[model samples]
Target: MTHQESLYGKTPDQLAALCGELGMPRFAARQIARWLYVRHTEDPLRMTDIAAAHRQRLAEWFSPALSAPERVTESADGTKKYLFRTLEGHYVESAYIPDGERATLCVSSQAGCRMGCRFCATGRQGLQQSLTAAEILNQAVSLPERDKLTNLVFMGMGEPLDNTDEVLRALEIITAEWGFGWSPTRITLSTAGVVPELRRFLDATKVHLAVSLHNPFHEERMEIMPVERAWPIAEVAAILREYDFTHQRRVSFEYIVMSGLNDSPRHIRELTRLLNGIKCRINLIRFHRIPDSPYFSPGDEAMVRFRDALTARGIQTTIRASRGEDIQAACGLLSTRLKGGI
Candidate 1:
């Protein structure tokens, strides 16, 4: 016999209809939604308030789609990287960093990636599949410290813009008052500036944004990130210019400083010129070494000089601290491997 679908992807109202179809009392749907979303109960069988027969029907027909990491590797610096399996058995990675009072979870939106930013580990893996809404939610819901999380970032595995529909749906579930109910302020979505969808996200949500802009010159950026070929950085900035980011919301640039590459004074001057009108901060990231990658992290002196140059020009800038370097959980370090099946 075919089993009834679980209520995972269903909204509170959709789940209500599911309860009626299962021959369950109507009120049971709201209770179940509360149990799954608010109470976070893992076992439907253990919901004792419901009548035993009704509970059995609910349990047998619908199964929860929660997840746990198949394997976890941690760095001594309090950084933990996880490999999670999707419903279809495809693997994805998320990272948790317990830094002081704030704990951040780097969530992935796709199984692999299609953006093909040459410096990114996920891009190297290639796009295997786009994650379902359930798969996307599972990353946050199944985190070991779900309640303690202070921030969530879509910076781990995929080009969120390519999977725009699912990413936005997942964001709605995250920010919707009836779902996780998280304030949009607590979430930040980074993109390589997928031109069209960037505006859609801005129009729909107030979540913060970070754009990957390693080099100001179109040709230079295109050399590292293949996405530059299609959506030029100039066009990305033009769209962003249409929006006001002076207050409330934030916009930042992610510039991975590679030694000897795009870190010279010439590049810096061009970068300053490129970002002159844009009211955004620049975050200098230390590029993590990966096989066959031509980039190398800049030395400490160079990093300091780079930050100072930006500061002198009245641009706010800071070098992002390197975390989980030992365990490969730092920026551009998450890659899924075949292991024990989930």
Candidate 2:
């Protein structure tokens, strides 16, 4: 018996090719897409339009994939953390946040992260293989509450910009008419400002962009994010300057506030200076402490003061409402935990 084709990885174009190879009609691709994405129909035989013989043949060759939540923990505030076991036997975590009317699922791009951010839990593990487009999208597509999804972010575990090819291909599959068909506006990809990968992403997609700039000063930033030692935030900002984010797309900075460490009026001034000429919002996130991290969460008062300081300097800044804290599933907390940590 032949091995099955990975149904999760097939793009519409790939699906069309699959249908052609199976000796099926061209229109069969449309039916298959409708069944897969629109109707959420997983059973091949349920596709009554396809001939019975072809249905069996297709079913034998393809199977809809799902990373069933091997472990699910729900927080008091309705945030859910799911540990999904990939087919490769790696466990990656994804979070589903239910905000009053809309639900957002934060997906992972790689099995583990390579970028060594002092604050992130995922960074403890060295680089694992990049997730395939299927693995990346399945975080949303295979979720039990997938139909209720209103937004998706490549912000769960891995640094999305590092896996540029897989990330972009997955976005294409997500927004394609034959796939999830979501507007690019519904998705956001975050990075620790990897300059070259970031340039390619900005040119190729209209999805919202978020740069992880925890500290504005180069010296202090380098202490936390090692990438800063190579591609400085100044260079990242220069590349961003070339893009027009005025109306079509959004651009934002993710500044995780560490108490007395990187949260102060002085830090705010430096942040404002760094973003001097740009029209972008700064989201001040509360620091989530990891083991041996030595960072403390910034108090609300300090966060508010910092936000106002940046705003007074003509920079749009907002202190982000911290979520998923009760579940140990907030910012900088996601990791595959595949081998129970290093």
Candidate 3:
């Protein structure tokens, strides 16, 4: 049996086109978008505002495209990792972090990752498949805390720019007025620098950009992040310099400080020189050790020292507070290896 196409991720324009093809009234497109996004309902029967005949037509050809997570593991620090089985039977993970008055949902853009960043668990799984836009949006739409979320991050399990088309569609649905109506500033996308797609992403969306610049030196970065060989971090920074980030929209670098790896004074000096013209902040992340991994987080004092040294160089830097490490949901630790049960 063939599955019905999903309606949940369609933008207003796409929905309008769909409605036209379905022989429904044009206004029905807006109603369906409101029901799918604003109301967060997947069942056409729940769309009370749409006419019965039109709703039936919608139900016949399209589904709401939402899926509840199969399992959840919560950390003592109020971080939760949700395991979701994708439509293709592959599994992915999403991390929910709740801070005072601000809750961020980090959603995955692909089932597994193609970017084999040495430190990232997701990349080790190899590429399963890029998620459809519906699957991407469902991470937020079907969340139990959907209503309470204040921010969204595309930093979960994949190189988002590698799955640029679907990721962009999901972003459009999240921020469009006829959809969730969220401000672009409320979202951030993390990438390990896919230069061509990065250019496309920067041109198309106003969401905050976070480049994974774990190291400043080219050869050294290539050792940890293979994307550097194809699209150098220096070139990524050069592309970023073309954009205006001194205003509301911001660009930040995610530097995972591993002991004896990337947390040296030379790295700091090179970082300062590499990011000289860009007005941006550096987010120093504590490395989380994965199974058999050689990388280790330098303790708090070293992290603080590194942050201070960068700040002393006139670049704003802050250490990202480690959360959900106990549950393996923190940065560089997300994977679906245990998704079969967990």
Q: TM-score each candidate.
A: 0.90, 0.92, 0.96
Tens-digit per-residue lDDT, 272-337, candidate 1: 888778899999999899888888998899999999998888889999999888987888877764
User: Residue-wise lDDT of candidate 3 within 1-342, one digit each (tens)?
Assistant: 134688888787888898888888888888888888888887888899888998887788875468898889999999999988888788899999999999999999998898999999998988887999999988887789989999999999988998988999999988988878999999999999999998899999999999999999999999999998899999999998898998899999999999998989899999999999999999999988888999899999999999999999999999999899999999998888655542
Which runs of model 2 end up more than 4 angstroms from their true locations? 1-4, 338-342
Off by over 4 Å in 1: 1-5, 16-30, 42-61, 337-342
Highest TM-score model number = 3
Please report the TM-score between candidate 1 and the true structure: 0.90
TM-score of candidate 2 to 2 decimals: 0.92
- Where is model 3 more than 4 Å wrong at Cα? none
Model 2 clash count equals: 0
Across 252-320, the per-residue lDDT of candidate 2 in tens digits comes to 999998888897778877787788677799998988888888989877887788888888888888887
- Residue pairs in steric clash, candidate 2? none
Error of 1 at 2 (Å): 7.3
